[model samples]
Target: MDQTLTELRTVNVIRYVTPLREGGSMPAIVEADDGFLYVIKFRGAGQGTNALIADLVGGELARALGLKVPELVFIHLDEGFGRSEADEEIQDLLKFSVGLNLGLHYLSGAITFDSTVTQLDPLLASKILWLDCLLTNIDRTCRNTNMLIWNKELWLIDPGASLYFHHNWSNWKEHILTPFALVKNHVLLKQASKLNEADVFCKQLLTTERIESIVALIPTDWLKDEPLFESKEAQRNAYTTFLLTRMQHSDIFIKEANDAREKLI
Candidate 1:
């Protein structure tokens, strides 16, 4: 993938359609000025902008690795955008999220993926499993999957729970090269038979330049007031360093995941 293609298109929110209550953060479906509906992740939601950062980094990383991820857009929520909303909680959320937010292009007519019903190719399953491990994503369990079957193909979504280390930067360094033991509970763990091959393919795609480019997509406002770093640049560098280091030590996580898979089978 071309490094220059990392820029996400920005769209102004034209209408607030409905809130997705299933998510703890209460993400909403909104219509953008571009005439498309998006599942908007508010910066002011309970999870805060860290969740937005995770979505941006994780979604873009999946794209770079040739995985299926919805198109990400920077959503501009003009002041007083949701003033007419009757729900107090939603009104407060919209009030705080008056500036930039993150959104995924809404996948209409898509159904929640059922791992038991939908068998996946082993290599493809391995790629998805490997990605979740790399991001330390804890949301893709059998109960919630966080996946969709759109147009007869599986697509990944809702990556906001990833990169939990960023929420508390105090022990961030200790997480580098750490094995993601949680992979055992992944929805597709049983089908991910080609993890090593998936690792090689992903490593070749997520080069240092590509990783830096993905981290650079994070908006500055979201990085502001971070207590851990002096500047947004430092914060970005920390994320890039963490991901690259983890990739270098991919064997640790791969072995961990394989071992976990062994127990299940």
Candidate 2:
């Protein structure tokens, strides 16, 4: 792990190849100036930039914890991006997303992770389960693992649905200590037998400085229009605080996950 905060490289989208509609956000594969394809998550999607913020924070946090995640980049969509597109819907999508977006490096020849066919060590599974609990990620379910096996390693993807508390920030602080009931639905919950080990290991890695660095990665454009906050900086501070608090009281969710697992097995 680098242990240093490096800004994501910004790449201009040169071509919109095709849309991956498997996700509700409708992220697409597009060719960038660097000649690599990225799955670009549009800001015009239903959840807006909140989804982008979650992707950046959650994905980077996973990387910080020594997990495999595809490289994340800032995809710049010019105003003239989809003018020639015959599909009116796609053109509108391009028009609305004519600014900064989030992209993940396309994993060629990757296969969806199936838990039934492959078994992971209890420690790794516990770590992953702990991560999802800390982020309040509700998308890593049996139906949609949101994980891929590329190069014979498990790679996490599409954390846009994590940090869902931000979607309704009315009482965000209250969520900090709440038990994540959704962990029972997590696909790896059954295999997460070492929550205590994962808790200690993950906390050591996710220091206050690291948490601040991860929250700082959120693009200013994503937070600028947040109506609840007076400025983007304040919004960023809130995210940093939320994550730091969660790390401090990790046992709350860890026990919840353990209980859920006990019920399962």
Candidate 3:
């Protein structure tokens, strides 16, 4: 287990309130010490442990893969909105099954829609796509636009839909491929000298050993006796295996990205 994950377990001062927003999953704004705010998310009712595990593992793995993901921590609360009248209004507003505060990225200036793929740096987009492929992330589509740009650096959010591939891994061939379009033809790709370096980044960052090490940090109690993964060891092994298999196939992705860059000529 990573020591950081070990240290995360010690954060016992979680406060709950009605979420500022809710969407695919419930989300609330939480005020932490040092004026840092985090968006806390809870596992929906009967969704089982998959949602929690996906957030933890997928977030950590993206960090491991040299992508920017929000810092995540596990929190405990004695009571949910079911116990408070103020929280009840939040429940009525969002109707989240579990009580938790989701972190908010307090951005300065104004939030406006970035309308074109060319508006973003292509190399950064390629890196995000590579990390998504490594994790089998399928939610970062054109419609959702999950990537956020702050100070010209790309940060990934809402990875709750990754990892399991939403049970659609077998049909990857039918998926509309978009990363190559941006990488191949976008002008930003021309400016990004480091775009070609992502293959090396992928190799160094997504190693099987590293993936297993992070997976070990998943709290066992949360997954107690879950049938999908018999034990933590099994879960770690499975994730490691998936990474290894994906790495073997990454050459095609890398080659396509390179070929796309070449076509920009």
Candidate 4:
């Protein structure tokens, strides 16, 4: 599965659907011209385009690591849409989001995964744990797994919380090796196995070219005006540098994860 995935397709928002007010970002379920429903993350949301950047990079990386992820796409919004009757808050959100937005394919009838009620294969659990650590994802705890069980398989979602360094560029270099301590509380930590093996697999698979491919998926406008970066490509390169450099310290994260796993046992 080392092949590059096709670039995400852009679709026009054919209809303004209901709001899915689960997270702070105010993502909505909208119908696209492709006749498919997508969970679109609006640029007007709290995290703004940076959250979309994380979703593209993290989701693509997860897929490359052989984990299931909803197909990522660009959903175009229109200003006139959703102008009619609606909650004032949602009306404001839709109005501001009159441009390109990040979307994850909607999984109809999919159930939120509850790790407590179900068991997961140790290797699969380890793979997900390793992926989350690589991305420095702090949002995958039991309190909010951010995963869906569709057709009895776990699909990872919501990687917008990673790359936290972007939010504050000062001393960003220090974040590369920042050990992912929050992983100790991850919902699937107890079920993880072969932690060291998972690290090696990710390090080998998540190469520079692969990372570039993932970053390239992000539109240029989204990377603009990023602090400490002059051009869009510069910001993109910063992400590549961070992830690639972080891989050099994979053992530190692996050891931290294993230590936490021991505490769980």
Candidate 2 regions with alpha-carbon error over 4 angstroms: 224-227
Misplaced by over 4 Å in model 1 are: 1-4
What is the overall TM-score of model 2 with all chains considered together?
0.98
lDDT of 1 by residue, 44-140 (tens): 8988999999999999998888889999999999999878999999999999999999999999999999988999999999999999999999999
Instruction: List TM-score per model, in order.
Output: 0.98, 0.98, 0.68, 0.96
Candidate 1 collision pairs:
none
Candidate 2 residue-wise lDDT, 1-265, digit = tens: 5689789999999999998888678889999999999999999888999999999999999999999999999999999888999988888888899999999999989999999998999999999999999999999999999999999999999988898989888789999998899999999988889999999999988989999988887878787456788888988899999999988999899889989999999
Report the candidate with higher lDDT, 3 versus 4.
4
Clashing pairs in 3: 28-102, 38-102, 38-103, 39-102, 39-103, 40-101, 40-102, 40-103
lDDT tens readout by residue for model 3, 1-265: 2323332432332445345354545566655553555666655423434666666777777777667776776654334434544555554433443433223343433232243543555556556666655565656655565666666666667666656532433443333322333334332333334544766666776666676777776666545353566665675566566656666667655566567656654
Question: Which of the two, 2 or 4, has more lDDT?
Answer: 2
What TM-score does candidate 4 reach?
A: 0.96
Ranking by lDDT: 1, 2, 4, 3
What C-alpha lDDT values do all the predictions have?
0.92, 0.91, 0.54, 0.86
Candidate 2 yields a Cα-based lDDT of 0.91
